[model samples]
Target: MLGDDRGQSNLDFLFGISVFLLTFLYAVTFIPGMFTPYQPGAIDLSAVAYRTSAMLAEDPGWCNSTAAGGLPGNSSWEDHQDCLLRIGLAGDRGHPNILSLNKIKALESLVASDYTLVREKMGLNGSIIYDINVAVEMNGTSLINAPWPSASSQNIESIERVVLIDTGKELFVDCNNPGEQYNSNMLNVTLNNLTSRDRDITIRIYNLTAAYPIGLAQDPIRVVSLSGNAISLPPDDYIIKLNGEVKNSTDFGFMKGDVLEITILNTAISDPIISAVNIWANSSCMPGRPVDYVYDPVFKQKSVCYPGIMRVEVWSYAFS
Candidate 1:
């Protein structure tokens, strides 16, 4: 009876051991799969919102016109003229070409509207002068290829004459004569040999409005030299007025048939800044009207006027 009991106990022990090994093996294989996390397929609310909003915010006009290359004729002219005028006015002021198209157009419209009223009310003869000129170029060339009177007419006459006097280049200052000695806080400038004999000569300082004197009061300033020659200056960084007025300076004056040398000097607080000096006739007996001018990057300069018309040029210098 004791032997039978021992045999039964051994069988039970073996059975228990088999069951424990099988359970351990099963857990080792299945435990890792159970604990591993699955990636969620749920959509991200924020990502969807951002992408949709970005698409909606894009400019409709720009998108519509992007594939349609080149500006329309009128739009091109308007853009060009606006840019030119800003550049012309950027005299003793800040940089002009840095402005965007929208800003420039707004400014041009305002100036044109205001000046139109002023000219009519004042009965100004000849033409109402504006401070700037806008220029345009198409297809990397200045000569407008469009037929006369077409939307892109190269001829200046076909376009609406917003400003009565139409010159490819806009004349800001219309003084009869200019003098020599001019002074400013930073430097002294002088013009010489200007007289009635000079015959409607004009000295244009580009980027004038960008520099110091912002308006007519600060500009259209006169300088008188010892020789009694008189010169009118639109405000420019290169030209300075003594006592803040040209009339008080002795070295200022214009002489008939003489070369005018413009000098710029530096001050303690500022380095000397000078622009290209351009001298030309205010008007000419040229039969052709001034074509709406454009910049020629290939030429590395602005447009050239037709034969018998005034030409524009640029000069630059570095201060010591």
Candidate 2:
């Protein structure tokens, strides 16, 4: 009877050991799949790409407040990296996603000099780094392609932002008619009552070949006014008189004679920031390069504005 009891006890002990081994094997099989964390880096990478795209498309950007020898805002931001606090392309001061050509150029210059600076400015840090690519597309073709040096085999995470480009268009006015004459050399351009929608209007006065008269050759000048009044400029420069007071520009030189070309340019106009372009001219229309004015091939006779789509692209390979 004692031997039988011992045998029964041994059998029970073996059964218990077998059950424990089976359970242990089952748990070990699933340890890698169930106990280990999934790839969390993917979520982080996707978030970073979206955040960068938003910053470029939405932020109006900021300049260094302390004046570290850098030009502040607009076209002046080009070439002065120390001055830029943020990088944005939007134009409408209040609107996001609208691109500004001036700001685009500024950022292009900045990134070209050092792409790492962009990542730092974007608040990216730690072991993860990124490769960024910015591009502008129109009609399925790339207009502007800016990218950092990156390997093609590296996994890339990319995002795109749609944007509108601010461009210039050519405008022609016939001052030969006596009624259109503001003076013998100047023509009257009615402001079209563009209250809030006013653009940066540029007026260039020259001859048939687009030559500025001898004494009137000078860079384009900005003039603004609300009521008709005489804003005197130097002799030998173009004359453009607007209703609003000039906000930011120097007075150009103009000469008194038969006017050839009277071009008016206005940018997206808003209160407290009215901008206009005025050039001086006379009958001679001699060709000369003004510090401010340069010939653009887009226009055959004079300067004009053209609209384009700005395509901004970003790429990251750290976790992608």
Candidate 3:
């Protein structure tokens, strides 16, 4: 009789089916999902914040405005509008984590003009609403105070970067002292102790005003040794290197307020000796300081380095 009862009752069949369905659902809870796509739009706030911070702290930005004259390095913050491609504080690629004060000021100006535009430049959109804040401190002073819009969102992210600030201070080398002027025959640059005599020396001269140093001074100038000997220059804009020999480019192409740099390698000469740096130039653009009342080291030639901080804050609404 038990062998003949092979088929299950209708009630039993329904109960068995219910148990199978419940088991399948329970197994699903333990199994790992394999088909779910990652949604960056849902949780990319931290990523955006980090990316933005890297852009400003590590990358050098570029500009292409008409007012900038197609040279990003030559343009100041006040010169161009909506032409900067990236918003970075770095001075150059070689100096990562270094900031440029000019670039900072330019970014501040851009934010003042249009927040939406600046956001777009940073690759932010409506879906990812954000707030940006930047503060730069140099020499225990605040160089920038760019604050974010007043918002009540509790979700905020930040990144602090230690960096060096480039002030781009003008090099003031006084070829002549006050009250005493050198005649048109020669401008003497006396290196009192001339320690690096065996090196190749480079001197750059700029003739334009510091504010606008684009126009070249049409001054006929030549470099000469103490004994009235001439130093030849390269035909084009190229760097001078020494291979146990002193080689330099004479095309200084100095504009008013422009900078002239002189470098001497230790391997170029046989011995260290005191020498006179003689410059022969037009009378109109002599070695005297055209604009006075500014007092600083006239013999110093270098960019001013300042301690700076880069703080990047990112925010978004959790509900959004």
Candidate 4:
């Protein structure tokens, strides 16, 4: 029996051990999901947190467009809570890691009122029943702060990512830019090229003052074309503020250093391709001629996102 040990020589033993090690290493190397768990539920919370953050940062979110009384695919999820399939902050479907300010505000309301539903929608309420908390910070200010999970849970995983929020940069036209603005009584704000669905545009025309005070007599200041269309009344679609105070269309009060503020309520209207507010002289203000001074190149408002950090923490329920 002792002599039979020669059957398995040193060379054969080394060869067998080397083959085993190679197979073991190959198996470990080929196995995926060691770093990124693409599936909804991951083996650990760390991967889950990363994936959840990605879902929020990348997806523009979609609601049931085919269901009864359904909303559009790109419509805000907060508006249609029942048909909400997923909650995402990315405003535009093509861009990723760029969140929508409107959606961020909606998430704040959701987390505060319906946190349980938020957890379920986030895929944290699976067979394992994990809990999650999200926090969004912008320059050290907490935009969103979700409540933490159970206190008994010992293990927790967290992940953070930098993202942008589209806060809708304020569009303003310097009234002082044009030297003729001091003498002109009519300024046209053409919104014929506006495409953004949620835009709060404010057009200011300062120094509407003349040599002598008119006070609705010499020139009755009236909003001629509401939303760039003639004879469109009702202050619902837009707002006219005389020196920062809300005034009706007929409330004519032109004064020195008068800042004619026109805030177009974009949400109430749809596909507003026409001019927003056209400051023109009525028949009494200027007869036999149209006083329309349109800005040479209309302002093309583009969507820009502000960068910030988003932290997502996940934990499992420690049932006693």
Candidate 5:
């Protein structure tokens, strides 16, 4: 009866032992979660915070003027709004992680005037309300400041994103800035707080293969000074160089592809710090036309924007 009955081969013993170990490990991992008060799946504020921040940073929200416009909506929602579809801070879809100054200002205003509306606009509508906080720091200065709740939350998640701001005012053009147009005939810039010390201004007149002079009597592109700033200089005031040849005046005009660089050195302003700087430009500065000018897009108001860090925090009380 016991003739060739080997109790159990080594392979069989090993297989059984492996199965027992796996089962024990599973029990150890799963059993604790079953008893714990805070399960991973129960509620996650961190996930919400990540999602919300992504929406605000990457997606430019839309505001509808009317459904009849046949245009679903526009990213320029800050200025126009018949219906608020969503609340986002990004400048546009083409560019992400760059907040629009207009939109940021609009959101800050909304938060202050209508907190509940902001939550609704952000798609945080539900029976269980969420306490949300948003803040933006630009160039180490607080641009949008919304304080967090004083009461401590059981579950709190905070996220920050480094974002560029599209101020819409081109101050300095190194010829390599993103979204720069080479054939751009007209140039507009804002110079703030020009010191009494000598200030250098460089302008690149692009796509002038025909060599048109920037200084026309009525609509001159070579404007030496700004409004209310006592800076009046003539063509001779600037050092103009084109194709390795320096010329005080572009009587023959400029050529194409190769640019003309005009450097104008400014005298020091008075002791008082200048709050802002502005230039007036011709509305029609498209290449191929005999027109180019530079001016502040926002003539009356001072639009000062800088790169900023946008922070979003989500908080909720954990259920005991």
Candidate 6:
């Protein structure tokens, strides 16, 4: 009896060992497959569904409008009319990268292809609103109009244009232009031009609250400086100095009703030559209603249903 009991105990121990060994081997093999970099919903021969349900769950508003059919069927005149204005203003302009209404529509279409609406809210003001956020790569492209050739004799171009934090403060003007000139002796021309016009070439930053002043010096909130083509300003939080004095962020913040004026003055010549000015801001801040409501026009009026204010922040850099 004692021998039989001992034999039974030994058999039970072996069985336990075998079960553990099988489980260990199975785990070692299965874990690697589970952790494979390929997504489970990826197009594999074994995958029954090629489309991922999670992709469908994302918000459709996040899609790229240009990639999708022009406009969604549900869009209203107010929603789609602004696009018409953008296209009109940008039509065949040398700069192809400006954000036009067509581009906005394309963005919407791209969003629809990958995502579906989960929830949306209608504001009291009769605006259809969304709280959707989408993750996208920063392609390092400017959404605003690209700076054109300097209308002035001196060539200055604005680079790294981006909208900073939204403050309700109004802006008068924000403009950036890059310019260049060719001469028989490139090195001599560059050196002589720099020496002569270095002090006269002033970049004037302004925050205009009323109509954009037709002349440069007529603006109210303005900061002027004379420097080389590239100028780097020191970093100070919440305060931006225009001349030598510190001022409020609202004085320079990019906001609704605010404008940025970039004036490049070529002092080398008898009369200082001023370059062209570029304008940008939420269209809602414009003083008057959209001029024309046709399928295409230069300016489109947008309702400030979401963000009620415009904010501007300026940073200066020197290019090589």
Stronger candidate by TM-score (1 vs 4): 4
Which pairs in model 5 have colliding backbones?
196-268, 208-255, 209-255, 209-256, 211-253, 211-254, 279-295
lDDT of 1 by residue, 84-181 (tens): 22112111113222222332233346445554432222122123221111322222333222111112222121111111111122122212212211
What TM-score do all the candidates reach, one by one? 0.16, 0.45, 0.47, 0.54, 0.49, 0.20
The models' CA-based lDDT, in order, is 0.27, 0.48, 0.55, 0.62, 0.58, 0.26
Q: Which stretches of model 3 miss by more than 4 angstroms?
A: 1-37, 66-78, 172-300, 318-320
Q: Write the per-residue lDDT of candidate 2 for residues 155-243, one digit (tens) a residue.
A: 55567666666543324443222323233322333343334343344443422332242333344333445553434333233324322
Off by more than 4 A, model 6: 1-21, 24-133, 137-320
Count of clashes, each model: 50, 40, 16, 1, 7, 42
By descending TM-score, how would the candidates be arranged? 4, 5, 3, 2, 6, 1
Query: Which model, 1 or 4, shows the larger lDDT?
Result: 4
Instruction: Give me the displacement of residue 75 in model 1, in angstroms.
Output: 42
The TM-score of candidate 2 is: 0.45
lDDT of 1 at 104: 27
Q: Which ten residues in a row have the lowest lDDT in candidate 2?
A: 290-299
Candidate 3 lDDT over residue span 14-100, tens digit each: 999999999999889755433232544565556777898888777776566555345435323234455655566787777888787
Over the stretch 1-320, how does candidate 5's per-residue lDDT look in tens digits? Answer: 56875588899999999999999999999998776547443545677788889989888898876544675777666666447788888877777888887688788877877777788777665655677888888767777764434436756788999988765432333333333333543444434533332344455544432343343222233332434453434555456666547764445343335555555545322223322222222332323212211342322222224678988888755432
RMSD of each: 24.7, 14.5, 17.7, 10.9, 12.4, 21.4
Per-residue lDDT over 235-307 for candidate 6, one digit per residue giving the tens place of the 0 to 100 score: 2211233443444332344432333322222332222321211222322232221112112132222211111
Q: Order the numbered candidates by lDDT, best leading.
A: 4, 5, 3, 2, 1, 6
